[model samples]
Target: MDQDQTYEYRGYRLVAKPADNGARCWAWRDGVPVHKLIGCDVPDAIQRTRNAIDSDLGVAARDGDAGDAAYTRALEAVLPELSTGQLKMLQARYRAPDRIITATELAKAAGYSNYSGANLQYGNLGKAVHAHHPVDLPVRSNGTLVYTCALADSPDLEPSATEDDSHWRWRMLPSLAFALCALGLVAK
Candidate 1:
């Protein structure tokens, strides 16, 4: 029952407290108790707490919370090369996550009156995606597609350091194509 004792587990501070049945381990984040593992001994409770923290962190990373900066940088690197219409469509698609973006919807967002204009804009966006992202993004028959901003699928697309600054260079060249392929850039 000593509240003073605490142990760090998976970047979380955990405290083991004695309960009537067994010991309960509580994990704290930013000094707030976030998780609790009851009906276990100190070691088991600690392990459970660690597992919970690891799972939470993994989910956060996958959900675009942990790697937001890297994702933003990757998108920003290709932003300049995109046209105004493509940029507008991309922004609209990104805003609607987990939802299918249709050509009509894209056209409306891009200030186009007809679906054909939106379809053309979508084609431009597809080319941009292929040139910059180089990822296999599926498009449905209705021109419906789900756009994810995270670079989780493209692990080989890493940010390389330069002599001047530690920024990711987005310049695509024929010479670097071989290297990029070797790094699984061309692989689906």
Candidate 2:
């Protein structure tokens, strides 16, 4: 029974009721209806359904795995600043429909080492975010299910000196006054 379950794509769901007779049709993961063959002249329907199923399974499996891997990386990155409970809190808050999760949120929720840790060295905290390595899990809460977890851009990878370019900063102590002012905060 796909009822009460979320497919999150193609709008597939279980439909117990049927329009023509008692012949129910699966959401086909979308508006399409999945049914039995009526005649040889009504060809290609079964094969097409099979193809859709296969394609859906293939993509879901691949993407799901990658999301798991990326999460591993994210965990490694978050570990430096947050306790496990905090990390879980983030998952509970984010990773649902209409929510756009980002590295910054992960860092904050996990108590990242600093404000910009999401885009800095020692940020990735892992080797890499391989494709299809993350498997997004749906957690049940208050009888509600939602999507959580993401996979991509290894959280373990150190922020290289290349993500940002052409934007640079420079400073100058044009006079002794400026130098003294800058050093005012230093030890006497």
Candidate 3:
């Protein structure tokens, strides 16, 4: 390829090279090299390089289609009571790869100051989840903590599940909930 040509995948720029029988690749931005990899074949090398660039472009945590769908569904359920601006701020929490909103934080968003008290008067977001089907719980970034509103009257929600779909769900008394749920109170 010509030096004038550039490969843009996700948000980073990659430089392509041809090896004896395959392709080699690297990425740079502002003179900083972020990744270097050798692919088994030319196409494989290009794909690998593109994937590396994409994964590193602040989307290290790529959500599966199911995760994205869950986000949209939950947002639809949570947005009606929120002013457009309020919704925007909450959306920002999910904008980056690793932001977590606690129950306390979400409580404030719902206009409740007490961490335990919920603002679930009729037509409120909380009320909707409790009244009907549960929304898919959002996955947390590796170190984030947030409460899920899935269980009734419980202040606990599960953290992000691993690739195998295993995680912890806390209850009102985290210890007790942990004890019982640890024994298998949560849905798999």
lDDT of each candidate versus the true structure: 0.48, 0.30, 0.40
RMSD of each: 18.3, 21.7, 16.8
Residue 131 displacement (Å), model 2:
12
Question: What TM-score does structure 2 among the candidates reach?
Answer: 0.29
Ranking by lDDT: 1, 3, 2
Query: Compared with the true structure, what per-residue lDDT tens digits does model 2 show for residues 1-188?
Result: 22322222344443332223112223453456553321111111222233345465664322233222244444444445644534333342233222223444445555665435543321232222112223343445775322222322122233323343111111110111111222331111
- The superposed Cα distance between candidate 2 and the true structure at residue 123, in angstroms, equals 5.3
Give the local distance difference test score of model 1: 0.48
Question: Which residue runs does candidate 2 get wrong by more than 4 Å?
Answer: 1-100, 113-115, 119-150, 153-188
Question: What's the count of clashing pairs in each model shown?
Answer: 0, 20, 0
lDDT of 3 by residue, 1-188 (tens): 42322476655677777666445777767778888776433333454565456566654322112222343354455545545434332333222122333444444554655434432321244334333434334445874212333321222234434322122222221121222222332211
Give candidate 3's whole-model lDDT.
0.40
Model 1 lDDT per residue over 1-188, tens place: 44534798667899877565545788998989999985233433554566568788874221222222333444456656757776566555434332234555667778888657765655554454445445444465888553322221211245443332122222211112222223333321
Model 3's C-alpha root-mean-square deviation from the true structure amounts to 16.8
Off by over 4 Å in 1: 1-73, 137-188
